[model samples]
Target: MNGKGTKARWWARTATTFVCVGAAVAATAPSAFAGATGCNDRTCIAVAGSGLRVESVTASTTWNGDFNGHLHIYGGGIDRNSATGFWGYHQKFTVPVGRDLPNGSVLCAEGWEHTGGGLQLRGRACAEVHF
Candidate 1:
């Protein structure tokens, strides 16, 4: 066979091998998130000083990127499960406050990433803010 024809066949074989390996890797990979059931909990909000029941936790979402979205939390830990892209966590719930939480209640939250066969909370937290 001609040298040009031999080179073309070699390239075709290499491409086929690449595709096969990629497919195998994808098929064996685990999903990034565990679905929308990881963060569903019924917990009441409480006062800062006395730990009095105040309000509930509610989960919200907003666009953070074109191909990726963010989980915006106001109250407590809501549904923390992202259904797409790399990795994500989302949660939503309700908190009972004395008509309006009386303001000044601490709103603490954080998101995490699973790596190295363990969980790391990434320190993506929001501090003392009213919902």
Candidate 2:
């Protein structure tokens, strides 16, 4: 009996299984800082403990002039939350050597909008720090 069809079907099943397992591992990786992310309609946030590098967070927003981005860390590693535009497009920031952080600290990013009243909080995203 010809076994070509059976071999092809077995190979397909094996490939499918591998793909599914790979995805599951990637999503539930032990490093929350390396796998986590937060997003909203106006913004997407990735912090030190998120999929982004452990030293920084990205204040992602539309490149339009109406939105301002801010980055902050809620961990003991930093002295204080950054002021407005500390990580903004207009400012030049240099990445320093990474620092060790106290366990369980969370890093967050906020998006602000230039409104008629004043700068109003638009959206925010956060990721918990994990070892």
Candidate 3:
């Protein structure tokens, strides 16, 4: 084969291989979130806590609206903290626990959403994890 034809075939094979590899990687990649708790029709919260200290909190929703909201961490004698912002779909917040929680204490993560304009449509969900 001529040089031009050989180069064209090589490029075609390389492109095909790259496309297949990319699709495989995408198929095997882990989902962005899992183990959702305290879920309603539109919102859900996931919390990971150790004793009186919370490790992480994830809030998620499926509401399709221009809304602002927050993720709140509470319980176990810890001061409640709200991480607020314009939220859509998912938000991850870190909880800063200043003291150790008492035994048998439970930590809860709450997700709240409200309309940005007048006549708000509010919704909330909460989930808890024990250390």
Best by lDDT: 3
Please provide, for model 1 over 1-131, each residue's C-alpha lDDT reduced to its tens digit, 9 standing for 90 to 100: 69999999999999999999999998886523111211212121222322223333333322231213323345433334434234222333223333333334444333334455655443333323232
Least accurate stretch of 10 residues (summed lDDT) in model 1? 33-42
Give per-residue CA lDDT, model 2, range 1-131, as digits (tens).
56998999999999999999999998887653433566554545555433234665454653332354343333335423444652333342222315545556665555565556876765566656666
Each candidate structure's TM-score, on Cα atoms with residue i matched to residue i, is 0.30, 0.48, 0.44
- Alpha-carbon RMSD of each model: 19.6, 8.2, 13.5
lDDT by residue for model 3 over 1-131, one digit each (tens)?
69999999999999999999999998886423222356655555565554434455555555562247665656656436455677566544555444444545555555556445533334455544332
Judge candidate 1 against the unseen true structure and give its global Cα lDDT, from 0 to 1.
0.37
User: Which model, 2 or 3, shows the larger TM-score?
Assistant: 2
Q: Worst ten-residue run, lDDT, model 2? A: 88-97
Error of 3 at 54 (Å): 4.2
Error of 3 at 11 (Å): 79
Clashing pairs in 2: 33-49, 33-50
By TM-score, who's the top model here?
A: 2
